[model samples]
Target: MARSEEQFKKIRDQRYEEISNAALKIFARKGFAGTKISDITSSINLSHGLLYHYFKSKEEIYVALITNVLELFSQAVEEAESNNGTPYGKLRWLTELTFKGDFDVALDRHMLLMEAMQADFLSQDTKEQIIDQYTTALKGIGRIIAEGQQTGLFRDGDEMELAAYYISLSQGITLWNAKGLYPIRVSADMVLDPLMKRG
Candidate 1:
C-alpha cells in the first residue's frame, strides 16, 4: 500500500532532521570549510542523493544549522524579555533554561555558533545575519539588566556590556562542561553572580 500524505510528510521531516543532526555533528567538529558533504552523509549512513534531496549543498546545511541555533537563542531572549517578573528572575529563568539540557548536545551547538562567528569564508549576508541576531539577543538581555539596575537589584554599568558578559559566561561554562576535567554541575547562581547587586 502507498503511504499517505501525512506519512510522507512525517518521513520527510524525520529525514530532514536526521540530515541536520548529522551535519551539525560534523560541522561542530570540522568547521564548515573543513567539512564535506560526504562527511555528513557517511556519519548518518545516508546516501549523497538522499542528503541532497533535503539540502542543496554542504554550505546550505551549515547555514541551516547556524540559522536554527540563532533562532532558538533569539526566541529564548525574547521569552525572557516578555516574561512577567523581576529582571533578576528573568535572568535566572534564562540561565536555568540554558543549562537545562544534554551537556554534550549543548556543547556541540555552542561550538558551531562560535566557529560560525569566526568563519570569514561564509557569505557576508550570513555573517551580517549572525551579528543581527547577537545584537537582538544583547538588546533583550540589556533591557532586563537595565530594569534590574533601576530596581537596585543589578549592578550599575552599561547594560549592553553586561549583556555580553552574561552571554559569554554562559557559553564559557558550556565549553568547560564538555572538557570533563572537572565534574561539577553549573548552577544559575554562577551565571548571575557577576550581574547581581551586592551590598
Candidate 2:
C-alpha cells in the first residue's frame, strides 16, 4: 500500500506553496537581507531540512515569491493593453483590477515590493530585474493614457508622467488598505474623480 506518484506530487506542491506563503510574510517584515531560511522555517511547522529539500536557499525562495507576484501584475497590465477598446476603458480596467484590495494589490502581497524599493542591500542585478518588471507595467499604463489623449478622453500630457500618476494612486490605495481602511472598494470613484475627464 504505497502512495501513488500523482498523490506524492500533489503533496509536494502543496508543501512548496505553504513554504512560499510563509516566506512572503517574513520578507515583508524583515526585508530580504534580514530574513533567513531558519526564520521562514520556524514560522511554519515544517522541519528545517524539509524547507531546504524544496528550496536550496533563501535566495531561491525570495525569487520564487517575487517572480510569482510580478507575473500576476504583468498579466493584469497585459490584458488591459491588449483590449481593443477605448483608452479610458483600459485605464479604468487597470485601476479597478489592481486596486480591488484583493491579492492583486493587497499590501501583504506587495509588502515586499515597497520594501524592495528602498532595499539598498540587494544585488544590482536583482534590483534591475525588479525595476524592469515595473517598467513593463508602466509602459502598459502609458499605452492606455496615450490612447485616451488621442481620443480626447484625456488631456494631452507626458504619458509616462500620467502612468506614474495612476500607479501612485493605486499605491496610495494599497497603503491605506494595509491600515484596514478598505478605501479602494469604497472610495475608488471619489479618489479617481479628479483625474477623469469632466465632460
Local accuracy of candidate 2 as per-residue lDDT tens digits, 1-199: 9999999999999999889888988888788888888888888888888888898888788877887888888999999899877776776777777766464336766788776656687678887898899889888888887887777777668888988887787777677757874533645455455456666
- Each prediction's total of clashing residue pairs, residues at least 3 apart in sequence or on different chains, is 0, 0
The C-alpha TM-scores of every prediction are: 0.96, 0.87
Name the top lDDT candidate.
Answer: 1
Model 2 misplacement above 4 A? 101-105, 181-184
Candidate 1 lDDT by residue in tens digits, 71-188 = 9988999999899988988999999999998888788898898888888888888898987887888899999999999999999999999999998988888888788899578889
C-alpha lDDT score of every prediction, in listed order: 0.89, 0.78
| Shift of residue 60 alpha carbon in model 1, Å | 0.4
Worst 10 residues of 1 by lDDT: 182-191
Task: RMSD for all candidates, in order, please.
Answer: 1.0, 2.4
* Candidate number of the best TM-score: 1
| Global CA lDDT computed for model 1 | 0.89
How much does candidate 1 score in TM-score? 0.96
